[model samples]
Target: MNIMSPPPRKLGRIHVPAVTLAHGGGGKAMKDLIDDVFVSAFATDTPRALEDQARFDLAALAAHGDRLAFTTDSFVVDPLFFPGGDIGKLAVFGTVNDLAVGGAKPLYLSCAVVIEEGLKIEELRRVAQSMAAAARRAGVTIVTGDTKVVQRGACDKLFITTTGVGVIPAGVELAIGGIRPGDGILVNGLLGDHGAAILAARGDLALETEIESDCAPLHGLIDAVLKAAPATRTIRDATRGGIATVLNEMAEASGVAIEIDEAATPLREEVRGFCEILGLDPLYLANEGKIVLAVPPAEIQAALAAMRAHPLGACAMLVGHAHAGEQGRVTIQTAFGGKRIVDMLVGEQLPRIC
Candidate 1:
């Protein structure tokens, strides 16, 4: 017996490889890219929701020590560099915040390094060393890692993937769900500082200011807040999508309405002016170090005091509350006293700004 051969289409001239907008678009090309390259190496039992986040079990960590908390994030800022943070510092802080906001004491990280060919060895050393310093500052260890070198231009200078492991005490039953009507909403510090700082570093627009990325590990500050009020239900550090998107998502997930007081939202005088001129909303911009807290009414004052005592949270302020009405939506009482919707950003407002 013999098998018939299938006809073959002639192969087209080799497609010159380049990074393009389509690679980041959540479409056919993006899926193909992830499947062909990234995901195969990082596959897990978890569903690949491809969301800004994913959820997993933390109960197992209770047996290990206390409560289990696990999370992963990857950083791909355009320059592999930025003001106040390179891809390295951002990598560390990103993982740290994820674990801390989940009510875990971040203990370690599994770092995966992908370095493209022709990357400066000095810069590479700097990145690694900076990561070491950052992890140490956060009291975390880089317990294990893998490194890969792709052909030059296959990646943007460098990309870092960090998966973190931590343990929240079992007594802490924090949930984004705990946000309730009349509860206080607060931010640890200023908004838009991190986003604006990175934008200025890009040198795209000539607007000049002393802005800098608010990239910092929040483990200590988070601990401070939790100690004062273990009843603090939900906490998230505004990162890629900014405070606006974060609040919207939190409200939707928790089935509550988040109403923020714009006049109470903290912003540096210069930051506000910059946003007005650039046609940017400070709320829609990214932040690296700040946290948004949903806490009990009685604990509001205590939470704010704990946050402000920390260097990283010196400007903590109450901004809003989760309310009974307007199910799963976020509204801000504008500084003008008018109400407007605050929704998840439809697209990246300031890409590469974090």
Candidate 2:
């Protein structure tokens, strides 16, 4: 069997010290930047012609499944680089997870970057290479992209928007409405690591911890889950709004009540203490590598076993279960033996957490 090597590091150099308006002028400067930075980093078996759009062979894509899953997301994390990942890795996996939750085999991604004039050229190169490495790990391609350099004051140092396309296998159906009373709520790993890690990275709180963002690609984990529990009702990546917001959405969509035990929710001691110090709720905190799944009771054990067997889902656990109660209501049994409503956050708890 042939094995694939990792993507090469730091493909090319940026002659300029900082990005300037000329880089976005669509002239020679822009072409050179594209060639040296993006092309070199994302090179594949097939040569890229630097075309306006990426072309895909119909037959090659059709082989994966019958339906296509498409999703797009934007990243503007305050710190471009974080403990476990950077903006580029977040952009790639963010869209990949969006497609994966829909039971799609993530295949391709489109990256568009908006860079502020005067931004360091090295920063741009680093982000591109991070994106390439992430794509290779996720088994997806960054096929086409656009770059725009705006005046320094017009935007942050850098921002990225990624669009992903994937194929959904035939006969696999997952929908929010499929959730019913008695279904089990499962999570792939400890919650709120990304949110806590980013908060600490900001340094405003003067707090310190060893927690790292759980940013990762989940296609392999999701595949293992489905193979074990084909009757899963829904799967969602807990991103910006965290598990609380995602659960609220699922509960509302399915018109079912969700009740979870706080003790059953897996959390790291570091994250637990961080949330306590900041008066933050882990449920409202963001996570890049965590997933909230609704599976039938009979298949819950099987799903848990499969998730534990996978690297990404090693921390998987049964967090809660669905039941008949007030429609669209979510309640949590507190550690103090009291129950309270776990509603959607009224406002942003931590901005740019994704």
Candidate 3:
């Protein structure tokens, strides 16, 4: 005779004030923490049943595109909370942007977080909620995840690793090597906001200003650009190494020289002042919500207009162009009408700014 398995047990809620080693012991405590903090927050998008892996309909994914895009990133920012975002929000958008830059429609993500033993349960809950909110804004789902609690001092308060899966529609090919001479380079908005904000938030500089991290999801803006400028060559988010690094990589990949106008590059007054005070070059600073794109000269106007129409690209500017010169070289035309080479970053500018 066949026998049926018992129904799944109801999820349990955690009553503890802080996490402990027992919560990672793979017992009731661990279940409680996951149920109370993670599952509940992601309930709307994820399956109710707790499975080892998330399953998706192949046909459903195929309907969106002809190819799949996968990307993963980890967030270990020193301060879990920041001026405009926290580690959780950063984890979601960071991975989403990675896939979006590849000309994909981000659909699903897997979040794995390592929590310190003494972290407050309330703080963990807040982070979980933030991830959920970010996923909603990006039109993606946190389908599955893992949580592990470690002893105090073994890890930071929390670190999140997110892996994303997306669909790249047919005829949407974007690559670094696709950049060509005479291509127009464009950027969404001001640079160095994220790097400057993190520096000021640390309180070590004794400097104060109203600068907030430009941490945001850019898939919507990207979609708009592609629709308008179908012949766009390449795109990259100016994250850790900023626009200077991105430009250099593009130049190297396409075997072309890129020249950017310093006056044409957008920079907020606060960020400029922060860089000047710290003796930092804003060009090499970090940004979380900015993108640098190369568009064919024929479609440059259409691309710029489409970007400016989007909320995220209202301040978008065509900062430079790609041309034939020294292979893999990037230069900047200063506001004072002088030119200089823009080299790759030598070392970490601001550790843990992302």
Candidate 4:
């Protein structure tokens, strides 16, 4: 007589309305929470086994590139939900963008969440579903994750940490040190939208304006730039410190002076107004879906064209150029026919921004 193996175990389910200490007790309750919230949301072809790790085909990964790019970031933005994106979406794109800026093709992500006790189960489910949707949009997979519940007040309502892995294609190498004098500086789109949106979402200022966060995955836009201008020098995402920070970093790293035309910098009217009223510089404000890059003057046009061709880069513009001067100095040519130094931020203008 032939013998048969036992069937695979089914994923557990949650019955509680809100998370509790029992869910983090490493028993049936914990398993149920993971299965119902994360597994169900990030479900894919792989078997939902209670394995300690996720696996991938080595050969398949090798096909995309010669080197691996790995990055991790934690999101603790105030207001779990916000205009244009939420903490979950920010977590996914934030990690994905980190890999993309390094010339990597983002592939997989590992999501870990710390949920405070008493958070509604529905809220947790919503975040998980958001992450799944963002991963799909970025053409990546949520391969593995962990969940934890902390006592009330021990943590925020929710915090998400996503670790990403991508493959950097062969023949592609980018670094800030590659920047040279006369290289043209470029940015993908309007600045400070994310910062302004977050401020408005907080309701602390009692200021109101229609500005949405510019959170987005940028691998596609970066790939287009590379294909169009093979000689592009480097790219850096303008995140917490925004484009001003990125430019200062590139200048310091490459030992070059950089100057930008304030008139050329793109800004949504709402964001510009928001910054003016709050006495904040748009250049120093945070952005989630913007990039600062240097392209050889010879290929600037091509790079600009490629960037403008993509939806994310529709407002791409050449804002500055590196030149020989006081090394690591960055200045902006004011729209009013004056110039001033653009220095690194002393402290965060907006705390808990992302």
Candidate 5:
């Protein structure tokens, strides 16, 4: 009998472990994954059956009936080390911004670590120290945690998952679906820098400028804007799928069509050059430390003024507006005045992007 050749040592058609494309397609795949992973990971002692947001006993939270905000994320970006920040800083900024963008004053964070065997303890210390420093800057604390170790290759160098809790004052409310026709869409400065910086560091290709990731914490900027104009109805950090996907989310949630001016969305010169060279849309690239805001037509000026005062918001600009529709469509006008539909992104990160 002829010996069977070891299945030709090769790469698979696709890489990375993730739910199917339909997972982000708003289907059973999405719901099941949320129910299984998200609820299970977070709802150990709390009820997992029903609730739009996690329900907590306020009796223990503080004195008065204060509104509570909770947010969580997993950091698994390649190269625990990156240009502007690392996994540690990302852990803190990522969660702090989540709370801040939603109009909440962040209070505390819970960090969990999964480490690979054979990793250096000193490296672990450095990441942890960075986390401590970041938490201090964000004015939050790492209140609790759990640690787990796996055999080498069973995990990456490290992975950090953080959950944040904050309180929102009365009269302050924002929702993804809060977008409306005539509402102005604004984005805080320079897109694609964070994502492209990571790609460049991989050294797979050479580019003109040695760019740095725009990874940052946006709490300060958000704080300034909300203070100036309380009418800000929505805030979203343009992560995962970037501005286009985020705008699409706004359109769906508010049941309105969003119209964006391609020329108005800001892109750094190097970022624009790299995206153009590689045929990528600056709109769909991820940003670690940026924000997208939707506010009333009348409050646009105040919003801009407030944002411009904060260093992070200096480059902020109005990027779009909403229109009447079945509540979930997004359109963008090209520089030449052509209209195009912006769809939700699907599949493993295309284009070695952020």
Candidate 6:
């Protein structure tokens, strides 16, 4: 008898309309599912050998920069799909922003997904394609990944985890520890868009608006800031806990104080209205595309100019400043000429938001 081999490429549409337990059994069904959905969608200039891991040339990566940056994040946003973006796009850009804010040029990512058994295969393909598009836009590649389908109710409709690696240019320095008194605080765009969008999408509040997630890749904007302000102290993406939580963390980490003008904090009317209606403070909301930067006073204008010149930073504002005072303290000058401490959130404000 003669032995035959599998096809060199498994490029075809998914046969089954929905996932099943067999898909997670690591059998022929699993291979077909992976090939049809993830492999095909993630195709790139790189070879698709479907190896256990991806390999890169050290010399090739070293050409871009000397230091390497690595970060990982998991996405389990409710509704899976929402206005302005979906979980797939969020997973990719979220990790990219992590590496970017660290002053790194994002390069590659690993996408691992867990799908509920009843999920539609088309939905899975849609998410994979979206992730691929986001990676391309961010100038990065999804080089490897894993997939698993759990029993019905074992997992949500889907959950995605992305791990990214980037390279930081030589002569670049940034960290919370670098924060100093009199450093200017700036945000790239409107805050609470993501948090508000998700809240409204869930339909729990019986409220409606046109607010959309501010999800985006920030590496381009970050590069612009670095070029204009090389002495920038630190850059942090305001995610789960929003800008207020980020400021508190920075103050605590650096043993300094952060003071922001509540009047100067930029916000969209829709977001502000949404928060007001729900008694939610926009400061404590999550933001996907915004960053909090601490820049030396002398370089503040340069950094702001560079940011505003970018599409993502068009609404950028000088919201706050670091100062000398009680360690780990954050004070906001209210619009009514009063001051209040902007403390970290005591409990989960909006859970399952990216």
Cα lDDT listed for each candidate:
0.78, 0.91, 0.93, 0.93, 0.77, 0.91
| Candidate 1 colliding pairs | 62-66
The reply for model 2, stretches above 4 Å from the true place, is: 1-13, 46-48
48-147 per-residue lDDT for model 2 (tens digits): 3456999999999899999999999999997999889999999999999999999999999999999999988888889999999999999999999899
Q: Residue 261 CA error for candidate 5 (Å)?
A: 0.8
Worst 10 residues of 2 by lDDT: 5-14
- Give the C-alpha lDDT of model 1: 0.78
> In candidate 6, which residue pairs clash?
none
lDDT of 5 by residue, 1-354 (tens): 897534422211212243234433445554553344333333334332343333446675654227888999888877777778788888889999999888888888888777675566456656777787788788886666655656668777778899999887777788998877899999888887878887777777687678888878888788789888789989999987889888888888888988888899888888988988888887888898889999999999999999888888888899888878656888888998899888888764544332
The sequence of per-residue lDDT tens digits that candidate 4 reaches over residues 18-122 is: 999999899999999998898888987544356688888999999999999999999999988888899999999999999999999999999999999999999
List, in order, the clash count of every candidate structure.
1, 0, 0, 0, 2, 0
Please provide, for model 3 over 29-98, each residue's C-alpha lDDT reduced to its tens digit, 9 standing for 90 to 100.
9999999999989877332558899999999999999999999998989788888988889899999999
Error of 4 at 306 (Å): 0.5
TM-score for model 4?
0.96
Q: Answer with 2 or 5, whichever has the higher TM-score.
A: 2
lDDT of 1 by residue, 106-195 (tens): 877877767676665557656777787788788887655655667767887788899998888667777877788888998999998888
Worst-scoring 10-residue span by lDDT in model 5? 7-16
Look at candidate 3 and tell me the lDDT of residue 178. 91
Report the Cα lDDT for residue 330, model 2.
94
lDDT by residue (tens digit), candidate 6, 1-354? 976644466454557799998998998888888888888778784334577998899998999899999999999999888888999999999999999998999999999999999999888889989998998899999999888889899988999999999999999888988899999999998999999999888877666456899999999999999999999999999999999999999999999999999988999998999888889999999999999999999999999999999999999999988999999999999989999999998889999997
Off by over 4 Å in 3: 1-9, 45-47, 206-208
- The residue ranges of model 4 lying beyond 4 angstroms of the native Cα positions read 1-8, 206-208
Q: Could you tell me the TM-score of candidate 2?
A: 0.95
Error of 1 at 270 (Å): 2.4
